[model samples]
Target: MSQLYVAVLAIIVAVLLAVALYRATRVKTKADYLVAGRSLPAAVLVLTLLTSWIGAGSLFAGAENAYKNGFAALWQPAGGWLGLLLIYFIAPRARKFAQFTLPDLLEARYNQTARVLGTLAILFAYVGITSYQFKGGGDVLHLIFPDTVSSQLGTYIIALFVIVTTALAGMSSVAYMDVAIGSLVTCICIISAPSLLHQAGGWSALHSSLPPQYFEIFGNYRLSPHGVLQSPAMGLVRALEFLVPTMLLMLGNQVMYQKFFSAKSERDARNSVIGWIIGTVVLETLIVAIAVFGRALYPTGEVAQHPREIIPYTARHGLPAILGAVLLGAVFAKVISTASNYLFSPATNLVNDVFVRYLAPNASNKRVLIVSRLAVVLLGCWALYQAIYAESILQKMLWAYTIYSAALTPVVLAAFYSKRVTAWGAVAAIASGTVVTLAWDLPGVKSLFPHIISDRDAIFPALFVAIAALIIVSLFTPAPSEAQLAQVAE
Candidate 1:
């Protein structure tokens, strides 16, 4: 029942998973391997979306907010469900468009300039997000081990595991692995949630033992009127930060779009979004509970302790040894599967959309696949290094969402809804959004612009400016020729 033994059990599960995925997937056809042959059934697609979306970010970040804010923290996840709602309406259209990545769709909708710019935007966003997951996995591994294993070494191992698996079969491998991990994780969460509550002495016990503010929605003024700016707490702003990125997620981005591509049909893709939304509502609530309980159980002042460790710490003490061990493995499964799936998407996009299409349009699919595998290694290394140097788990998740949303969301949305969007518009939107967001931490910048103004205005302003420029320019300029217009309609 030692934590060390529990940790060992988790590693064994991951190893077994790797071996099983390696044997099950024998990649040859690019379509079959990179995207599950573009024929994923509803069941597999649903579960994979569920697993891929809810990584350490949900478990750790959700837990952190729950720990810090109590029941009011539930609003954090409520925002994500809103995102899933948006996805349901948007996904089928994306799939019907039949593209490799979001940028692929934009290229068809607008022009090559749009495609190229969107691709660059996603690369920055995804790498930043994936890097955090890399860092989180490494941190978790180091915590699972001790003196015999250094944190840096542990990070490298987890990073390697992710990079190697992603390189194996692209989305094809990520999908099947997601199904298994998602199901296992679902069972673990169901088991762990109740036990965590029990350790807190049941719902009534948890309800009464805390500060009076624990149960309030605005416990810390997070949702207050002033929350948008000049507020003492991060409540409203945090919620906005969570909301805007998720809104973009529902609109653009390859991760969700790929799910749409892999769906058996339009119905399946739409249904999967609803299913994921439902699951997010339930699981996020459960994670929030675990985080609150964890807060009460393990306070500060340990040699090594942080909020992300809350789930593991509580499971080791609050649940029976065997059940705790199983849940622990599920935690790792959540982290690794997400890392594997996310890292693969951008790599594939880079090779197929940018490298093969622009660099050498006539390159065989086989060669493109090989290049994709290499991109996975190169990107994976970048993510792994950042993961080691990064702080706790939640920040990385935010980093990626912020960058991607600010850059790609506008351009992605423009593709589907705006007929006037042009290549120049796409380029301008990406450049403006990225510049504003990246300079967010600058000294004079914050004072001049401030997080309040800078945050809201950054992406949205860039998006609108891009749209206006595209419309004005396209009006004066000739529209797409009939042939290009045909491609756009398709």
Candidate 2:
């Protein structure tokens, strides 16, 4: 029966790779490889964005949250929903200001220094993101073939697959394959949710099976690691801590903007947000419901230790063979899609923003494309190295989000909205936000500090320093000239 599951997964992957092989031929130029030659329609844009955003972070990390907290686990995605509302307004503008990468946007609006620093920040955060995707793909494989494939070996296999597929056709392969992967995952999850509910003895059983706290906004009690009762205000802060990272990630996600840049028109980019918002809410909600339903049936055992495995576990054990295979394959494909997107984004930053822009500005399209492929291989190796020492995907997701949100989001947003912001201000914001987040998380530095700051995650302190520096430094420094402002405005 498990062999049946593995066979179905192998078939789906083969079909996806074949499709990628076909798309690889269409990629001929730097723009073609990087942004699909800005040719994607709104429908393609919507699905790719959906697939990229909901990868392992939302599927596994978020499922783990729902497995523990039930409905209130929505705090993780509610942040993205908040971010999406703002994204609706920013989407068209991003498409209009079209560039290859986030660092391109930074350099246009700020300076070369901002571009270099922005690339550094993106590499740190995006590689961490890609690492977890490898971990997630490995987890799914291990669940299906627990005896045959160790999780570490599974990670290496997934990493190589993602790197090859991404390097084969770049965004062309990633975006189009996402169309199939996204639709399959969404349909399977929606269908499985009701079936799982029925098998678990329906909604009432799920409610009774879990703690009442699981139903609450922040859950019933917010206790410290020491088990002391925390104030409600502090609990809300903790919830915000979860919420803000998703919100910030969505707002500053280079992956989203790159997809937008790939759109055929600004209108296509703007319109896709509508579909993306709908898909995310429905699919993410179903993911939580699926995990919660799984918890009702498989409450104990390995799922407790590795809560992130709940979704795949439910698909294999709780669903019928065919439905289980479909669900598992969908989850696996999504992880691959997301890993490709994250893995590819920083490669673009290193190649387009750093290598070509600085090192070989006069390089031909052919040379640029070769460097891009090499960049993917090198970065993919780095991400896989991180996967070897993998921890909780949820912890890693927030850490990556904190770095991007605090360090880059403020400056990225200011570039479009404020002509008053100076290049030095952007530099200060980027540097301070990144340094604070990194320093706050360092073991030695954290050990030396007081609990109030060190005990907390990096989001608040990093954001505070970043935003403050942006405003204060901008006020004190010279504003950008008309030429500089117009670069972003147009």
Q: Which stretches of candidate 1 lie over 4 Å from their true place?
A: 3-25, 221-235, 303-305, 443-490
TM-score for predicted model 2 compared with the true structure: 0.98
Tens digits of lDDT, candidate 2, 1-490:
8778878888888988997899888888999999999999999999999999999998899999888777778888999999999999999989998889988889888999999999999999999999999999999999988999988889989999999999998999999989999999999988999999999997688788888777777763365757676787877888888899889889999999999999999999999999999999999999988988888898999998999999999998999999998899999999999999999999999999888888999999899889999999999999999988978888888889999999999998898888899999999999999999989867788678867765478899899999999999999998888888888775
Error of 2 at 90 (Å): 0.8
Q: What is the C-alpha lDDT of each candidate?
A: 0.70, 0.91
Q: Assess the local accuracy of residue 471 in candidate 2 as a C-alpha lDDT between 0 and 100.
A: 94
Q: Which parts of model 2 are misplaced by more than 4 Å? A: 453-455
**Best candidate (score: lDDT):** 2
Please report how far candidate 2 places residue 155 from its true position, in Å: 0.6
Q: Count the backbone clashes (under 3 Å) in each candidate.
A: 4, 0
- RMSD of candidate 1 to the true fold? 3.6
